[model samples]
Target: MADIAHTVHVALGDRAYDILIGDSLLDDAGAILAERFPGRRYGIITDDNVARAQLPRLLKSLDAAGLGHTEIVLPAGEATKSWAYLGQAVEGILAARLERGDLVIALGGGVIGDLAGFAAAIARRGMDFVQMPTSLLAQVDSSVGGKTGINSPHGKNLIGAFHQPRLVLADLSTLDTLDARQFASGYAEVVKYGLIDDEDFFFWLEEHQAEIFAGGPARGEAIARCCAHKARVVIEDEKELGVRALLNLGHTFGHALEKDTGYSDRLLHGEGVAIGMVLAHGFSARLGLAPSQDSGRIAQHLKKSGLPTTLADIPGKLGSTETLMAAIAQDKKVSRGALTFILTRGIGQAFIEKNVDGAAVAEFLNEMRALPLSP
Candidate 1:
């Protein structure tokens, strides 16, 4: 409470919830939940990495509040966001006797949030859950919208439901534990909000990225801004019927890359996004949809922040052009078997395009493989 925090309201009328951002909120998690869902016991779902660094503190807080709780710690990594572990989480919740009125707290990164939220969705038809996002990517994006699910062997987040959380507690202090790579990966998403539509925010980030990296107050401001943007978009288009689809600017390309890498630590979600965004802008430029300078600047910023901006930067073989194209073809955004992409006119000016020429995309990918990615 003391550290200058902010709350962004996701206006969903009866389903409305506030995204609380700050430090010490984790210690106050139980009280917050008690206020929101009185007399509800909690089932905490987390990954091992988060449990080691963050779970102890959260458990201590819940105990201090005298609230009863149980937790299931899954092996950490993107691999955990699958059907096998979804079953494990559901079984753990049932084992803890979590009823429909009970609460499930997702206390990890995006993977845990998606998996746990999906578990709550199918458990007894539906149940309320809270989001305690620890990673930068989760706090800024995945934890906000009700987009919960696991990766499909065919594509990322191909299997999931639209189940919103009752609340989202994004404790900025939790980010302090993230390694440099994780932090930068999250920043990629932060930059995404700007690239989606906010020209001013993108420029602001260009100037203040160092401060954000240093975990200065600007970091909180940046997170709040990103959350506000997401809340606004979700409010306008709860489903991906229209404007909300703009949010997936880099996801189509990113998902293909993720599938190629087997969704391993070899390429974190945000890292794939970093490269995808560069490719997105690069492709947009190649097709005369956007300016190359805009693409170059974004690539340079991502590179300066220590994220990969090219397929060459990713480790291991990414397979043939057709292999990657097949992955994109399976993207959920595809309609009538035609590819859909979120392209851009420039930074902060992204838009959706249906039935994108598949051959043109393949050519762009082929050219990207050979050209220097610096610009």
Candidate 2:
């Protein structure tokens, strides 16, 4: 039974699926899939990191249930989400002779989910896949959204497709293998849901932050809450056509930082997002749209969670404002060559702004680079 704690259903008619959040779901995945999917075989696509830590458990479950499967282990990290790896994943499925009716199981963090799902989307002209997300970031955000893709040299997620998974299995136990920094990085996304449009959830996160880190009951609840909120938004805007854009509160600035950092460990995706969220709020305040105090408070919470909440927190050197602007220009949100950003009036009040002045953003970046750290 895998102690199923929470299940959030994404009501997308024929493309619909459920996100199962619970303890040890990985150990029960074989049984669950066998019952739900029947005779279909599975191609388990994972990263090197997850293969070492969690692959055995999954294989064991599948073996116990007499289910046939193939494993493709790619290198870990953001760089893996590229054309080379995408081809490798797609080829792996093809070589395994996995038919369109078979399934591709994305069994890792955001990187694996994106790469594998994107591969499934193109392999044999679109195959069904399942998200068995193992990282906190993937479980709460990337895994549920169905926004599968690979990154390009121009910017993040520049090449991709919206291929919803057949199901999502987020096992809480897998988080135990994450180091403090990795866990904290993922927590940044957890905080993002509240910043998007759920002030009450944000407050709850503040109170339960420590408990979540400690792997208390609040951890499961928080994951489920974030999933439910995202599921609702996905239903309303499956393709990021409107309200779903709110889910990218800090992604505009964050993606630029990621490209600037070369997607290295120096700046994790969530770390960039943490700093980006602070920048978003600060930028709003500078424009007289949100109070300055709100940015400070958000920064404080993120910092306390062990995340970098400012440009200065990035190690070594950073790209110039012009460089960042160039990256932002290449962002997916750009429409008709106009910059689009998710700006906020306060916590939980994010809105899509398509006509943001590029000059103001450039000036803000320059100023942010010079500003002293808050005391």
Candidate 3:
């Protein structure tokens, strides 16, 4: 754990919040919260898996600060972000007797953060909450954005809210316990920040992949960097009405794959994002927006990092190109029945492409589906 931490403020006027990054953040959670929240009892919402890994340190901090808290620990994984569990969580928080002035602590990966954050949004007509994201995915992306929701029968994150957290606490040390695949899955989001707008960051990630993987100074730096990028975007467009949509560069395609695969371990969210990013680049090339070699470079980098970069790389059936196209039509980015995608001129030059021809997207899906899986 690093001795000192870095802070990135999401400037939202009265709705502003700070994302505290680096190692040993959990160690300071007590003091940080005591000062900011003041005399509040937090109702923690975590999953079983995250509880085993992160709860002890957080609990120790709360105990050290003499802070009181209630808890709702659900089952782990994407499954936990369902309507059933969401209802359960809301009921549990109410049972804990939290009021509008009270706060909730989302203490896990994207699953817990989304579920709990959404719970905070609807419960008691919206309660203030804090983010204590425990996974690399949460630390870099999901935890900061305040896009809380659960997957719906028709599509991923079809049900969600734009309820922002009061603060975000990302303890980079928590990544040390993540399995290799989980860590790599998160690395996709880190690469996303670079691919979206910062070419130098992408090149730097390419050069220091090893250091980024190895838990140390570089890891903290990488996490902080991603958070900084996300913080800037959130500040610029707290809602997805403008530049904020740039953050979904690969998500339009990624969410379709996730829905097809049932949002299980068969295709983790970040894994889907990795493949989606490659597809985003490949589709951009198909549209003559980016060079073919540029797409190939992106694919090769993801493959080298043990990430799946193609539809064929997916473990199970992903239906057909038509099915994929159907799922894509349901993308939240669609406007007035026209598809919108964040296509790129190249790496670091992503742009919002509104009213992209649906026929062309279908053709692109067909081509991606026809391609052989990369090894």
Return the top candidate by TM-score. 2
Model 3 residue 163 CA deviation (Å) reads 1.2
For candidate 3, what is the lDDT?
0.88
Per-model C-alpha lDDT, please?
0.90, 0.93, 0.88
The model with the greater lDDT, 2 or 3, is 2
Report the C-alpha lDDT of model 3 over 53-153, residue by residue, as the tens digit: 88988889988988998989999989888899999999999998887888999999889999999999999989999999889999999999789999888
Model 2, TM vs. native: 0.99
Ranking by TM-score: 2, 1, 3
Error of 1 at 337 (Å): 1.3
Tens-digit lDDT string for candidate 1 (245-324): 99998999998888888888899899999999989998999888798899889988999999999888888777789999
lDDT of 2 by residue, 14-71 (tens): 9999999999999999999999999999999999999999999999999999899999
Candidate 3: where are CA atoms >4 Å away? none
lDDT of model number 2: 0.93
C-alpha lDDT of candidate 1 relative to the true structure: 0.90
List the lowest-lDDT window of 10 residues for candidate 2.
366-375
